[model samples]
Structure formats: C-alpha cells, structure tokens
Target: MKRYDPALYAILALIFALSCAYVPLAGRGGGEMTIEVVRDGKTEFRAPLGDVPEMLEFRGPEGYNAISSVEGVRMVSADCPGGDCIRAGTIKNAGESIICLPHRLTVKLTKESASEMDAVSY
Candidate 1:
C-alpha cells in the first residue's frame, strides 16, 4: 500500500467543490429564481433570488400587504378583506403566484431559462 498525502486529499476536495459550484453557474439547470410583485398590472417590485428580508411589505389601495421568503415566497400578513392570498401557500417554483383580488396585488415566482446548448468546434 502507498502512503496517503494530506495535500493530495485537500486538492481533490477543492477541485470537487469548485466543479460542483461551476455546474450551477454554467446554466445547466436549477438557476436562481426571481420574485416579481405586480400591482394593477404593473411591476411594483422585481428582484433576483438573494438575501430576502424577513417581511416584505407593499402598499395597496386597501392597505398594506406583507410577505416573507425564508423558504419560499409566501403571504405572511395582509389587510385585505379575504385571506385567500395568505392561504395560497408558499410559492417556490416558477410560474406559481399568490393573488389578492381585494388588494389588487400579485406576487409571482419566476426564473431565467438556461442558454442553448453549445456545439463543440475543432
């Protein structure tokens, strides 16, 4: 049996970690999702997935609406008459949305599609 070198193991671990990180950045799939808040058919807020605040508040004609994104986008509180928006549940997947008809507000989750496959060139 051959002796194991500590440096070799560290190098291998670093390489593996880097490769894993690169795969997601290469646009293969599983890209970061975006949160889009639309009010009266206009985009009130739009941001890419990142450090989401504990509570995101938006002003509507009815009153204020609050949402959170700890795990996924969800309505935590609202001033609307009906609580249907709160019952919409957490929306994490792209195309999912929570609508508050009374408030005339909509929060939707979306993601950017990966680029087309690259062809090898000699």
Candidate 2:
C-alpha cells in the first residue's frame, strides 16, 4: 500500500470547500426579477417586474424604444428593423433577454436574490 500525502489531501479538501462555497443553496425561494435596459454597451435603465403595469421609453442611438410590462416584460414599440424586440413577447424568468441590433439596445431579466453570493472568498 502507498502512503497518503497529507499535503495532497489538504489541498483537495480546500479545493472542494472553495468550490462548494459559491454554490447557492436550493429551496432559497424565488427572487425578485428586474428588467435591465442596455444602450451603447451600458445599462441605461432598470425596473422591477411587479403587479402594476408599466411602460418605459429609452432613447437609443438611432431613436427611441418603448417597453411595457405587466405580468412579464416585453418591448412594445421600436423602430428597429423587423421590430423583433416587440415580437419577444414577455419574459418572467431570470437569464432571459431581448435585443435590438439596429438600435444597439438590449433588455434582460435578472433575478435579484435576497442572499447574494460573493465573487471571491477571503
């Protein structure tokens, strides 16, 4: 039998701990979702997806883009070619997005967790 190296085991354990530390625990419940509007590669506006319906307008490079949200989020009006953004009906979940290439604009839904994890462990 070969002898076990203490240093190797210690390193393996540390790696495992660090890897699991960032894993979000399940059953934490759903978080609030928000719509982030990006223009010119920068976030220009953000709004919460709540009960009351809302309409937002943002000035893009070419013109203006209008977004509406009630139960979910959607781009209601825009001058972008094909009006694809308007076709992206509604998104209620995290990681969903809508983009308009002509206007160089993007709308995304992001979940804001109550207990957010840190990027690094010190």
Candidate 3:
C-alpha cells in the first residue's frame, strides 16, 4: 500500500470544488427573466407561453388586452377597467412590471426558474 499524502488530498478537494462552482447549474442555463404586472397585488399572472399576438386574444378578465415584450417574457393583457394596464407594455427580465392603480393590479418579473415561478407578478 502507498502512503496517503494529505497535501495531495487537499489539492484534489479544492480542484473538485472549483470545478463544481464554475459549472453552470441547472437553473442557470437561460438568461435572467421576470414578468411584472398588477392584479390587486393579491393575485399574480402566469407567464404566457406564446408570443404577443396569441396573448392578446385569450379573452378573459385577467387576459392581457395590450402586451409588449420589454425584454424577453410576455406581459399579458390585463383586465383593468381603465385599460391602462393593457397599455403598460411587456417585460422579460429581472425588475420590470406594469401597474394598474385603479384596479389594484400589478405585474412584475423575477429571476426564479420558469417552472418554479408561480406567477409572473408585474
């Protein structure tokens, strides 16, 4: 049997840790993203799957009437009474959102993974 070298072991451990640290984690594969909107602040909107056109015609109170892609994610059309929220625009990154004060609605985007994201709060 060969003698164990403590120094060699420590160096190996350090290399392993450094390699793991540099390796891209599972959630780090994509660019930073977020969705921001205002919906009474109590409820949040789900990130839309399709493009801006598809989001416009969903046809629901919470459905987005006017949407814009500020960055990457889609800001769905809102049902705010004044139609202000509808015109707020789209967001797709950390720290972007739309607000509808009249209806107490807001939309915001975050860095959480798409699957993990509960709702795109703008």
What's the lDDT of the predicted structure labeled candidate 3?
Answer: 0.54
| Runs off by more than 4 Å, candidate 3 | 5-38, 48-53, 56-87, 113-122
Q: Evaluate residue 101 in candidate 2 and report its C-alpha lDDT on the 0 to 100 scale.
A: 81
- Please give the distance, in angstroms, between residue 122's alpha carbon in candidate 2 and its true position after superposition: 36
Q: Candidate 3's residue-wise lDDT over 25-119, tens digit each?
A: 64564554544444555544555433233432323355444455544544355565677655655555565565666555565666655345454
lDDT of 1 by residue, 37-72 (tens): 999999999887575676799987777899998888
- Whole-model lDDT, model 2: 0.78
Positional deviation of residue 24's Cα in model 1 after best superposition, in angstroms = 17
Worst 10 residues of 2 by lDDT: 113-122
For each candidate in the order shown, give its overall lDDT on alpha carbons: 0.84, 0.78, 0.54
Q: Using lDDT as the measure, which candidate wins?
A: 1
Best by TM-score: 1
Candidate 2 stretches with Cα past 4 Å from truth are 1-30, 51-53, 113-122
By TM-score, the better pick of 2 and 3 is 2
